[model samples]
Target: MDPVIDVRNLVKRFRGTRRTAFAPATPDSLALDHVDLAIPEGQIYGLIGANGAGKTTLLKVISTLLLPTSGEVRVLGHDLRTEEAAVRSCLGLVTNSERSFYYRLTGWQNLRYFTGLYGMDRTTLERRARPLVDRLGLSRAMDRDYRTYSTGMQRKLAFIRAFVLETPVLLLDEPTSSLDPLSSEEIRSLIAEECQARDQTVLLSANNLLDVERLAGRVGKMSQGRLTPVESASDLDESLRVARIWLRDPRSRVEATLRTWAGGSPGRPPVRWEVQERNQRTLLRVATEEPERMLPEFLQFLLGSGLAVESVDLRSVDLEEEFLLAAREAEAEASGASP
Candidate 1:
């Protein structure tokens, strides 16, 4: 089966500042660095990255809001350069910005006008949008000017419009941004239903790892303009667990020993550690994936390392920890690659 969205050797660059009378010239910055992605039908591909990491840049390039510097992008086999109109017809994009809507128009009016561009009449638009509006808690504000809506309401309006469009592919950037917990969950449910029931392909970029954990079938991390797919523990084995150990008054050698242990022998699970100043005491946090048989031995190793262990918390692995782990790994790789 052909992918619903295909991107190959994609690259995007923003020109840096030119030399001025008092400043030196700067090299161009790469927003996307030869990124390749293929999202299949009915799949939710969740993209997570830090600020300025090129997640949004990739989305905008696909949505045609920003053109790529080079390489191929296609939606439904329609080339983005030659078939932009066709590509646009196949995707509904939900951005966090309220600037996408007309300030003076009511939410309902904006919805009707946008859907009208897609050839949806009033009855069809209302039939498709009303339930989504109500479900997202935008029903009460539908008749008010969009500018009067709060940031969260504006985001809901964006979702309502995109959901009603019924496009085959959905490009969502921070769909749950500015939303409360309840609203975020509602949006997640709606996204899942749209993909599972309607078979719509969704590419979701979000900082909220929960959104990705709950909705995405595949998760990828974007770091320093490169895309790396990673398997979330939730989607993998249920036996995977994260243990966070807090140490009090730990010796300086405690960290070196822990690092050595983490990188020690073959077949050992990876461990990550960080120091924190908490409540006027020095605290050391060590997080690792420990299987049932390894926990006791790992604890003994820590005890023998001459470290004072304060408390240990163990639970199922979560996306938050996975996200942090990926970020730290990326930072480490970049650091090693630097001259």
Candidate 2:
């Protein structure tokens, strides 16, 4: 079966500017580098990456917002270069940036106007959008001016517009960003439900790992303009277990000691540690296959260091850690291949 979205050696470059009036101009920077992707029909393909990893650039190109420098791109068998109108008709796009909306128009008015472009009548638009707005907690502000809407409300309006269009393909860039936990969950649920119910093919680019894990059946990591697909998160790293130790201390001493011990300790289990700030507390994450063995040792070490442990949690390796580990491996491989 042909993929709903297809690409062959796609590349996009942005022009760079001169350093100064008298300095040499910079060369064009490559945004997408010979990238190839094929997302099958009715599949939610999640693309994750750090900022500026070309995730948004790829989506923009697929959505016909930017022209590709070279190679082929096809959406629903329509050539992106030659049949852009066909591609646009078949896909709905929700961008992270909120500037796409008409500030002076009310939220409902904006939705009606955008849906009008898609040939959806006001009645149909209301029927489709009212539920989404209500579900996303934006019903009260539906008639309010868009300029006065909060960042989150503006984003919800974008989603309602896309969903109302009911295109066969949806391109979502950070749909859950800047959303509170409940709102994020609602958006994720809507995404999953909408795709399954409508049999739509969704290409989602997000920094939120949980969104990708929950919504995407097939996952890929985008780094340095290259995409690496994986069967599942567990394939990212051999160590599938993680232990998080919540330390009550707000000081950096705990982090420093952990780093020093991790780097200098001998015969230690193959584990990697990360210190994160959490609500005036420090979270020390230890990734290892042998969490049971490492937990005791870690607890002893922290107590010995005079750092008070608030609590400890043991869980499977989440998508966040998997993303980090995969990135590290990709960087290592790239370095090794460098001449």
Which candidate number maximizes TM-score?
A: 1
Evaluate all candidate structures by whole-model CA lDDT and list the values in order: 0.80, 0.83
Quote the positional error of residue 150 for candidate 1 in Å.
1.9
Q: How would you encode candidate 2's per-residue C-alpha lDDT over 148-227 as one tens digit per residue? A: 99887887788888888889999999988888887789889999998899999999998888899889988888877878
Model 1, 1-339: lDDT tens digits are 889999999999999998999999998989899999999999999998876778999999999989899999999999999999999999899986667999999998998898889899999998988888877778889999988998778887888888888889999998888788987898898889866877999999989988998988888889878897767525643634666666665445555666666555676666554444566444544444455667676778878877677888776656776556556556655667210
What TM-score does each of the candidates earn?
A: 0.82, 0.76
lDDT of 1: 0.80
Model 2 misplaced regions, further than 4 Å: 22-24, 233-316, 326-339
Question: How badly does each model clash, as a count of residue pairs?
Answer: 0, 0
lDDT for 202 (candidate 2): 95
